[model samples]
Target: MSKKSYRNKIEIAKEKEKNKEELLKKIERLQKRINDLEKSLNKPQNIQDKTELYLKHPEEPVVTPTLKKTVVNEQILWEINNSQRATKGLFEIKGNYEKICSIIPNALIIADEKGKIIFWNKAAEKIFGYTSEEALNNDLLNILVPSEYHQFFKEGFNRFKDTGEGPIIEKPSEFIAKKKNGNNFPIEITLSAIEVDEKWYSVAIIRDISEHKRIEESLIQTHQKLEGMLNNAVNTLVKIIELRDSYTSGHQKRVSELAVAIARKMGLNEKKVKLIKIAALVHDIGKVGIPSEILNKPTKLTDLEFNLIQTHPQAGYNILKEVDFPWPVEEIILQHHERIDGSGYPRKLKDDEIMVEARIIAVADVVEAMSSHRPYRPGLGIKKALEEISQNRGILYDPKVVDICLQLFREKKFKF
Candidate 1:
């Protein structure tokens, strides 16, 4: 407002304008010197003369003795501002990178070391039903992770932030995640660690596995249906054969139960155990071809009638060989009567010549038949039955099968 102050303001503005002009002039002079130096180098005589007056241009800037070369000042200006240009380019690249993240099918989320979400892509929005705007700056724990697992994950996340270590980093694991609408579903998540400004950040790729789970469950149900049908067919066949002699069918059911327990106690896998069970269930299926009067004969039979009973194994094999089974059910039934030594009837299969399923069924069949009461004889006690297998462990039965059978009865308390 004072006259002297106003005049001083005008002088300051003039000084700045003059400085700007001088800077521009210096740039122009530098460019001209470069042009003249280039022209001098192009001359044919200038190369041959090797003159001390290398620069023909009189307007060339003076080189101070402290510096042997006169450097390009404009080049220095470009170098000084190079980072400014680079910052602009980097900004553009950041946008393109974000576009790529958005287009990926899996949800991409970047959360800071403190577990605060900094980035959420389009797929993240779709999967969690939360827009990027809503998810950004939110706590990753509260937004997506189930509340019940909050403490479990909070501890892990804190550990990750401090030491850049956790069980989940770089590992793909399945977990349950909650959506915005308060429904929970399965998700497969993979996490990666990145360091920025001496701080750890998590880059997570999340995928919805709801559809996969549905498909898996559907497959399991279909398998169960097929299994039920197979079981029903086996039961119907067993019932048909049992119609001739009730004692034989009841004996078969108890044998199958004991066989399954023995197989499992031996740590045989499910498929083999399953085959053993089915084979034991139908071990007497050949009796359907035998005359009912012979099967139901209450008194001790003659040697010829006993030979007729032994024919049931081969006959049962013949009966079932035409039917398709997942395993060697027919062969197993045929070999059930064969002993481990070269003594038993039919093919007289010796040790290792018989299938292991048959060997297991042989032990189980002996135990259950001896333990149950017969129509003509009192049931031998379980003590006597165990002693029978113990006496015949290596000679007539598989050693492993006999040991497991003994353990099942004595320790595991398995029963028919």
Candidate 2:
């Protein structure tokens, strides 16, 4: 019961240890197979099949053809290695592209080469007032394109199919489109193309631009109304000045005409010319504050009277400053009497300090005042008026403005 029993117990322990070692080897092999399977899942199955062939026959070279194109099936493989689901093969998992189209805010419509709608997104349904079921497999022209544009769209589509290009592809274009409710509205569309298995498919990104168009039209109408009101107000102000001084009833009107012509001759834009004309029409508005006796004195005025006359510009500025104008009307009135050398009245603004509209008006004012009949003096004629501006071109008047004024009278035969 001593040495023999001990030996038998040692043999039993050795057998158990050997069995454990074999089981450990089997577990290692199983882990290596799992790792290989994971690596194969990441690679293309066709490439993996070729790799296996090369590994099995090391002496023979495997000639695999290079793949120039790939066909992406919409179907997704959900259960690759699961035995229970393998019988179902690869099933579609509800394509990502279809989901994206359904969720986007803008309308998306996909069509075949014959203009037959294949896919209509949710946004398309909302925009065109048509359900996806109603639009699918239908002719796009009959459903969405307005009757007036059917022929044009058909011609363009034919051209696009032949050349794989069109005026609307990859570029946004606006067109009048019809909805399911039979309402026609403006729409902006961007088109793109994709080739699938040798068949060309067109995708259209659409947006309803009816609201934008309405907003643009409204702004234009408001702008026109505001312009009309401004013109009426300006005419009323000119009439007020005329009422105060009967002798200068037509003086402002004549100055405005000449100022506009001179501005055009100087290559000023229409907007600037309009501003200059308006300022010239009311340039002497401050004269309404002067006494009638002083304005129509018919003789040389005294020093105090002359000083009072110089204050008209400042008074005109004060009167207009409270009113809001797109152009600097108040500043133009204040600076119209200013000179290039800072020798004029009121603020005595110099050169660039004076508003350009004011500078243009100053030249027109001198020419008109000198040529027209004033109560204090006789009409001096156009020749003398031209000489006055030509003599003091750079000193009293803007040189460019003076040159343009002279050219207008001499070359263009400009008349008030």
Candidate 3:
């Protein structure tokens, strides 16, 4: 080739090399711009002014200098805002939890799976007489639990560590705990379990129930005394009724016994049964107004005499209506003679009109009156009394009460 032609080829090669160098520099500048964009996207932005402006005028456009009215990567901005909000929420939750643990009235204790105390609150310090600093790092069983219960606690803790469950978790348990002063007292503890970073923690809420126990015991004693006094008053009223009718000496007492048994057999609650018994004991109180001659007469009662006798229930009501009784004593006394089919006396009250206690007493009254020897007639046999009730099951008496009464006689062999 000629020397001039070779030099021309070299010039073409140099021009190509210079163009390639300029292209590389432009590419490097573009890469630097991309890096600047990424940095700007990642760096935390002051969103307070923008947020306030947007909230104040939601329909207006945000024109903040930091965001610069240019289109930017929205996903990165959203992630940044979300992360900040999540971090704020987590910190708020932590602060609230600490506040709650500090202010709760009951002693709060937190321990790891190994029973090492991790958190002890102010209430615990007050209750166990140990400062929070003193309780931390101490074994919970050794510090709070009595020596006798240490083995039991250990067993429960082991079981809880394996299964995250124990008999004491999620339930309130009462037991004795020793204070720092060596005095033992009753404590109620509720335990809960939590998992943090793949580790188990136990939280115990303890309440010293000494005052509550003392108050409960005192209330029980007061209730017992009141019950005894009420029972004495009932006995005195029963005696008063007995004195009025000497011939039927223990009739009221026997009726009361049968009524109580029937009430219990009918599944009536204790309060209802008690009311029925007391009302039955004084059911004949109205008979006190009846002339002793009519009550003791051995002959059949004349129409006028029977009519007068029928008024005894109302007379008894009149006497008891003014007296205050927790039970419906006055109403039961007036309605005992009432039949379910409106055939009974005084008001001829139908089924639902009669008080439940009165219906129970009516069945008991009939059974006792039939089985016992009345002044006017010989005593009917128990079989005959049962037969009478069985025959009149629902017509004149409550079928359920009658059935219970019959069962008492046949199945339970109940006797006066």
Candidate 4:
């Protein structure tokens, strides 16, 4: 009860605590020494002996009782910290997934094996006119497909689920879909599948193609109309030349047919073949101005009259040059009389200098003119006409065109 007695009691309690701490330290030192002795003994033991020890004491911990192994609290703390960091990472990943679903314009949706909608995004609402909450757990086909194609779509989708083969998933398909208002329209659709927790889900990308199809049809119709108008114009131009000279009226006609034939046999293109026909029709159009006596004379003309006849080509060029034709009209009219070897013509042009169309007309003109009778002279016949060109192939005509013409006459027995 006295103050001195209380002080003595406090000192005795402190000394007892100090002695207890010393005893614990001595025990730890002895345990470490015992652990070192046991490890040295276990090193030389065979695996069979170690297995027997494990079997005999199955409940015992792997560490020895002698080893003073304190729990590594710092390592446990490190592992706990790592687990918390991993959990935080998983939460961030979940947030990113939600963000992506919101931003992607394409319908990032999932449907179960039965074609029931599971997850839908904002794009699905915009495109299909169904909100995410309304679409979930609803049968996708019944919601979007027209009544006529619903059964067909069911068969196709079920087939894909069973066999992993179907036309819809492998390639995009065109299908008619009905809107919420019951209006139907064409859509291009692509489908893909993904497995989530052992169940397959399908996602589709759809685009409306009604406008594209309309534009394509319009282009086709316009092209056909333009082609018809062009043909009518060409026919009218051919008729005009036929009305001019009775002697050469049908002269241009027969020559046009034969010229186009020869051009095709020579492998000329459609454009060049058309040019040859138009050029042949207008070859002697200049004769419209010449006196009828000069053009349709029943007898041979004087030297002066023949010289005036040569002027028809220059006159034809002047007439055709003023009016626009798609072809090089003036060049066609000018070069028709110009020979390949510079031998026969108003202006003596030669060889490749002459256009291919003009070269064809030259052969056609010579052949038809000589084959058919003229008012001034008797017919030379097709034989002599072919003979004339064959004999003077390189001399007065292009040799390649000349050869094809001869082969047609001789071997093929080609008729006018």
Candidate with maximal lDDT:
1
Q: Which 10-residue window of candidate 3 scores lowest in summed lDDT? A: 60-69
lDDT (Cα) of model 2: 0.74
Q: What is the Å distance of residue 244 in model 2 from its true position?
A: 0.4
Model 1 C-alpha lDDT versus the unseen true structure: 0.76
State every prediction's TM-score relative to the real structure.
0.70, 0.69, 0.71, 0.51
Q: lDDT per residue, candidate 4, 139-248, as tens digits?
A: 88888898899889888888766544467763567788766667787776666554333445566656555654565566567656755675676566556655656667
lDDT of candidates 1 onward, in order: 0.76, 0.74, 0.75, 0.68
**Model 3 segments beyond 4 Å from truth?**
1-97, 146-158, 172-175, 321-323
Report the lDDT tens digits of candidate 3 across residue range 1-416.
Answer: 33365457546634533442233223223322333334434545656643453355333121211222322222322323444553554454446556656656678787888899988889899999999888999999897889988899899999877666799876778999989887888998877665434466776778787865675666678767777887888787777766777655488888899999988877889999888988888888888878899999999999999999999889989988887676778899999999999999999999999998999999989898898899889999788888988999999999999999999888866997
After TM-score superposition, the amount by which residue 284's alpha carbon in candidate 2 deviates from its true location, in angstroms, is 1.5
Candidate 1 residue 59 Cα shift, in angstroms, is 44
Q: Candidate 4 — what's its lDDT?
A: 0.68
lDDT of 1 by residue, 158-258 (tens): 88887666898766788999999999999988776654445777777788878666756766787787789889989998888777788889999999999
- Alpha-carbon RMSD to native, per candidate: 21.4, 21.7, 25.6, 27.2
Model 1: CA > 4 A from native? 1-81, 88-92, 99-103, 269-275, 298-308, 321-328, 341-355, 373-381, 411-416
Q: Which sections of candidate 2 miss by over 4 Å?
A: 1-94, 110-118, 136-143, 147-173, 190-203, 264-270
Q: Pairs clashing in candidate 2?
A: none
Superposition TM-score, candidate 3 onto the true structure: 0.71
